[model samples]
Target: MGYYLMKFFSWVACRFSMEKCNSFGKVLGKLTWIVVPKKRKFMAYDNIIRCLGVDAGEAERIAKASWVQFGPMLMEVLRYPELIKDDYIKKYVTIDGLEYLQEAIDNKQGAVIATSHSDSWELMGAALAQYGVPLVGVAKKQKDSAMDRFINEYRTLVGMHITYTNGVREMFKMIKEGWMIGLITDQDPLWSDGVVLDFFNRKTNCFVGPASIARTQKAPIFHGQIVHRPDGGHHITIYPPIFVDQTKDKKEDIKKATQQIANLLENHIRTHPEDWFWLHDRWKSVREKGLD
Candidate 1:
């Protein structure tokens, strides 16, 4: 089932322009928003309401848009083969701060790209790779093996390196070899592995790997975001590096860097309410352990 779906999407991506693919994706997104189970719908709405401090009606609107956004995002990813040829970075994406990332690369210590599951994150790595950045994207494998291979194939096709969710030690090794590692640390982590952190005014389990990597390797961490634009293109902003404090207090340094990451994530979600992956139960750890 997953393989056939991948084939179908890849065919559509090859046969259609990005605009047409996006239009189809918008329709698919709307259908998904309508047909998704109540649990998912409720979780999205609840998260938006609590995190954004919006009323139910407003939250519902944002939640629907959130689901819809994923459609185009996936389509864009599927169209990567075409995008790679057309110089999409120059034609489609408006970059705000390339120099910051270049600076990280120039420093020769490798770098950590602190990004999240926002907009076309897959494309983010692809774009960086196209621009000659040694980008290694950390991804969660899909439940189905076929689907996982399908996704990773597209990643490698566009020159982005792949590592599984549990590849932190591998990430460090790559960093030592001067590779820029991208970590999507926005989602919920294992209860035992994550540290408690304040996100959107609530306590939740947060992955400190990005912070840990930067602190241990003395690599600079650069926070970045990608968002859809009104012109049917995308905008990417690579912020300046967030240097970790080497105060001989490893725990405190990781905590502070992770908190800074959490703060950046909250600000991004607030600014682009509909672009985030709200379908994930981001605060499940807090709720289950009664941390809130």
Candidate 2:
């Protein structure tokens, strides 16, 4: 069944032009509005409400627009094997602050590249891998074993490496071998290990893994974002290096650096409200505790 489904999807993808795929995405977006349960929609709306506060109305518009963008985004993922081969993909994605990445590589020190679940994030990893950068991405295992296997195989097809969330040791080993680690740090962290930080002007628990690893390994940290362009393409902006200072107080350094990253994330989301994933309960833990 999986083999047949994959082949069918591949055939459909091959037959459709990029413009046709985008038009189909618009139709899919409308279908999603009809099919997605009201409860789920309300939850997404509520999350956006909290994040945008007084601008909730505007946020809702952007969130809904994101559903449209997300459809094409997923289709792009399905078509990635062909998309990566085209030189024009470079025109859509502009990488800033690459010199900082080069500096870290030249120093023989592996670095951590942190991004969020923003616009077409998977493409960003594929681009780096295509340039022969030993990029390893950490991801949570999907619930369906078969689906997880399929997605992993697809990623590897484009030359990107994957490390499951449970494999901390493997991630450490990859870094030690001078492979750059790409992590999505915007998700709500598990309660025990996360620190409450201010995100979108509200208190939220954020994962400290990126900061922790950077400080421990004395590695340079770079922030990057894949912004959705008006022309239906993406622009990948890489920010300057956010070096983790290894002071005497390691915990303090981790907290400070993590907060810095959170601040940057907040600013980006503010500027491009529609490009972010607003469906997740990012502030749930704090709000549940009556802290927010």
The positional error of residue 108 in candidate 2, measured at the CA in angstroms, is 2.7
Model 1 over residues 43-73: C-alpha lDDT tens digits?
8898888888899999989888877887887
Task: Report the number of clashing residue pairs per model.
Answer: 0, 0
Q: State candidate 2's TM-score.
A: 0.92
The stretch of ten residues in a row with the least summed lDDT in candidate 1 is 86-95
What's each prediction's TM-score? Answer: 0.95, 0.92
Q: Candidate 1: TM-score? A: 0.95
Task: Give the clashing residue pairs of candidate 2, or none.
Answer: none
Backbone clash total, candidate 2: 0
Question: For candidate 1, what is the lDDT?
Answer: 0.86
lDDT of 2 by residue, 65-157 (tens): 766666777676677666666664566556766777777777777888999988778778876676666788887898877667767777787
- The superposed Cα distance between candidate 1 and the true structure at residue 32, in angstroms, equals 1.2
